[model samples]
Target: MRTTIRLLLKTYRFEFIAITLACLAMAGAELYLTSRLDALALPKECQFDQNISVEQGFATQPEEPVSDPTLVDSCQEKAIAFSDSDQRSAVLMSFGAALPVLAGILIGVAVVGRELETGTASLAWTLSRSRRRWYLTRALLVGAILGGVLLLPSFTANILEHARQPLIDPGSSFNDGGIRGPVLVMLGLLTYSIGVVTGAVVGRQLPAVIITLALALLAILAFENGVSRWESTLAEWQPAASSSYSIDIVLEQDYRDRASGLIVDQGSVFNAAPQVDGGPDGAWIDAHYDSVALVVPGSRYGDVVAVETGAIGAALLVLLGLGLFVVIHRRPD
Candidate 1:
């Protein structure tokens, strides 16, 4: 056990240094942003929550009382107008965020690939360390390093966004932008893990690196595009029709103002359609949205970024299982 520990510590020294620097870099940016947020006196309400950001809020007044902008030009204008300042930080962070994934490539080359390519492992195994202990140590170090590879950019991005600006309820983009962080981290981890597995399988340095990077990119794109299709086709379950209150939103005083606080209209929001009746067994899919309400006095609804934490976790587990199978099957047989 002690030998195993010493081997991992020595073998993973570079990985440890990389994760430390990345974390510090992220933490430094985050702390800077924390001070900035204080300086700006950002309100707690404006801070985004993952759950609340995914939903729509009561409309804020349009610069002009434009009817469903999405109606006129497909609301391409709304999406376009904000493109410049909208996600600049998030976009920039993504590129910077992908750097740590390179750690995987380096470690991949160093760990199993180097040993196997040089035929050094056979001699090393003749020593105190068994082949199993050696492989397990390598995998453990690579896994820990890969996990950190996934976190740095996101932590920095979060800090940058909060510190740079007080996330001032940037309309629909808030939730959309918030979702990007987690998705990007997943991208990084997926890429890193691919490198680790490929390195373990292929003993050559350059070939292993190339294969891992290519497969990682493909995996990221495939998953992203697939999930997007799923979101678009989601058939929102509706509720049964009933007599209930609804609000009449209007443009007033240069704001998309709520005419009244959930004004009691005779029509039931429940029966908005055949599916959602605004009540249980209804089509109002957003009922669990008790977290926040439509545009209230101080708060706004973020795009409901309903990420299934469990699902992402499950995907990681599945990939890990496959990796383990591959590793075990390939052992010196």
Candidate 2:
């Protein structure tokens, strides 16, 4: 076992180091971005300080509101215009947040697919180690490495997710769906497992990498949209507030006439159709919302994470079963 592991390490040392550095760099960049966002949301209250430049008269003075002038455009504007850099940060964050999924694909290809492609896997099986032990050791080592890579970024994302500026859209929350720390880790595992299974079935590195990545993307989309579709069946419907409530995981908010109880419009806080003839009027929608359905409450964010992780885990098990069949039936060569 030690020899196999050491051989694996010797074989993939460069790849492992590169991946570790990339993960650390990505985590650092994310933390830096989170700090920038935190700075923007800093309160505008005055502070006394010796470092203040009395002549410049700026340091001791309170910081100006980071929100743009257009915030007066409407209620929605207030929510949307918190910072000019917010939307940009959000876009960058989205890309940075996908690092784990990307990491999983690369690791899968390098660890399993490439080995099988180069006949190294067959060579390993011929050694003192049994084929089963060889495969399992490789898989477990890769899993442990990926899991360790996840720790810092996951913690950073979770911390910043909760401390996000109030004006940022709830849907954009870092804690949502696959974006959550634990969920991302599960997704990584699922993607890695898919890669291993695909490599075994295809017996080629390039094809396995392509198929595994494609399937990983499909799985992510499925989780993001597919699982949420069940909200209507599972959510608790309550009377919509005339005023905006704390925006959490609201599944549906329906606008209805108070007197006739006729449904006027319905959607999320950001995209709800207005009762009026025109597009959504932020003020009007706020006043007219008569009911809402809560899918997953803010307090139960952990529950949603568990459910999503379980769903991913279930899919992983299915892939594992298929892979087991392939490996058991086929020769390593």
Candidate 3:
């Protein structure tokens, strides 16, 4: 193991250094952004106005009209400052999230693909008695390093996420899924697995990196959209509120029959309602149906994260197995 580690460091010193520096920069930026966001105090009016209820959703309204012009001006200034800081933090957070993924791809492909491309794999295979052991030791070592380096940035991203939304629970909110928490580390591992498989198959660094990136993007899109649809299937109906939190993921909106407790088609309700002063009778519709929304609440965030993590873990295992198979069978030419 120590020999393998030394060999890996000697072979990919530049990449290791670059990735480490990038991760450190991401962590620093995230911390800086979080401090900036935290320093900007929320105005009393803004802070007090923001309220959230599971049944009623967010209820944000000023308790009383501002009579003092100076106080009103101060509140507006603070609000604007907070908004600007929040936007900056969000932008940096996104960039920090992508750093680990890119690092994983680079490390994974370069580890084996470069060796194969440069005709060094033949020499390495000649030195090692067992190809399986050789590949596993080097790959696992690199993966562990990548995962360890990624933790710093991932932790900072979590802090920034919470700083940006101090009122909401980051754990329960799915607003930024892969950008923070354990999901980021899992995503990094998944991408590394993708790179290793692609590199093993392609036998070239640059092409493997390209293919790995494309595959990773497609996987991410599929996960995001497909999981959203799946979450909709698991969605439950809740009372539709006039206002909603930015963190909430509402899947569908419709009305429920008050008497039958069944969802009423919105178009059908509008069409069946009697024409009143200008359009459908608002009074009649209100009396017959109550507004409802199909929502995947924050409470289910753990379940959603678990499902996504499991899927990614499964993909990683498959990719790693395939890469190992290729390494064992393929000739180092």
Candidate 4:
């Protein structure tokens, strides 16, 4: 096993080093950016209070200053600065998130596609008695390495997310679903598996990378859509609290009739409002309707992650199986 690992490392030393360095850099950058964001403390008035009750929606909050009026300018300036820093962090984090996918594609295609493309696979196959064993050894080793390397960036991403929303629990929130935590590792592994299968079938690195990228994108889109639909199914009406500190995934936001417990359409309510003097008046709407939101709460984050990871794992198994079958039967040249 050590010999095989050494050989794999030696053969792809450049790619291995590049991916390792990139991951490390991403981790460092995330930490630095998170710290910068954290340094900007929000004033108590600017900070969201999540203790609001369902009956008194954010819209119904008393129109009185909670903090000294003098602090308003300072709060605005800090808020603006924080917002800018947060945007930068988001952009950097996006790149960091994509690093694993890029690494997986490069590593996976190089592992098998390059060998077959350059006709070295023929020699490797001749030396190995069993093609299945040969393929598994390389695939598993590379996959493990990729997963290990991805952890740093994933961990940093979690930290960054926590910094971004200090009030909300990162584990419970789905704010950056695919980019943080174990899900990122799972996504990396899934992409690697995809590249492996594509490489095995295409037998060419460039084309395999392209196809793998397309497949990965499609998989991501499908997975996100599927998860959203699943979440919608699990969604329940919750009091529409201000989302500044909330971790719920709101699907729909509308007013619910407090008395009848029925959803009221905003447009219809506005249209039906009696006009006083020369303008339509909505003064009575607030008394009859309560703002409610259909949402998947943060508590479901674990369940969603589990289901997503399991699906990806199953797909990885199937891809590995298909790749193995191809490698076992295909002519190395």
The best candidate in terms of lDDT: 4
| Model 1 ranges with Cα > 4 A deviation | 1-3, 33-88, 124-134, 148-153, 164-185, 233-312, 329-333
The true-versus-predicted C-alpha distance at residue 187 of model 4, in Å, is 2.0
TM-score on alpha carbons, each prediction? 0.55, 0.72, 0.89, 0.88
Candidate RMSDs in order: 11.7, 9.3, 2.9, 3.2
Of candidates 3 and 2, the better by TM-score = 3
The C-alpha lDDT values of all candidates are 0.48, 0.61, 0.80, 0.81
Q: Candidate 1 on 1-333: residue-level lDDT in tens?
A: 667657666766776677667656755655554554455443332222212221223332222343544444533443343333335544555545555556555565556666667777556656724555656666656666565555655655655654444443322233334333555455555555566567667867689988887877676567666655544443221111110011111111111113332322223433332452434433232332222222211111122234433445566556655555655566431
Residue 80 alpha-carbon offset, candidate 3, angstroms: 0.4
- lDDT tens readout by residue for model 4, 1-333: 888899889999988999999999999999998988789876546654322333344442333455666676776787788778788888988897788888888888887888899999999899999998889999999999989999999999999988877766888876776779888888888889989988988999999999999999898888788878888997888767543224667777778887889887667666666777765575777777777777788888888889888988898899899999989888887
Clashing pairs in 2: 240-290, 240-291
TM-score of 2: 0.72
lDDT of 2 at 224: 76
Candidate 4 global Cα RMSD: 3.2
lDDT of 4: 0.81
* Index of the highest-TM-score prediction: 3
Regions of candidate 2 where Cα sits further than 4 Å from its true position? 1-5, 44-82, 166-177, 242-247, 255-289, 293-295
Ranking by TM-score: 3, 4, 2, 1
Candidate 3 lDDT trough over 10 residues, lowest sum: 48-57
lDDT of 3 at 99: 82
Query: How far out, in Å, is residue 208 in model 4?
Result: 1.4
How do these models rank on lDDT, best leading?
A: 4, 3, 2, 1
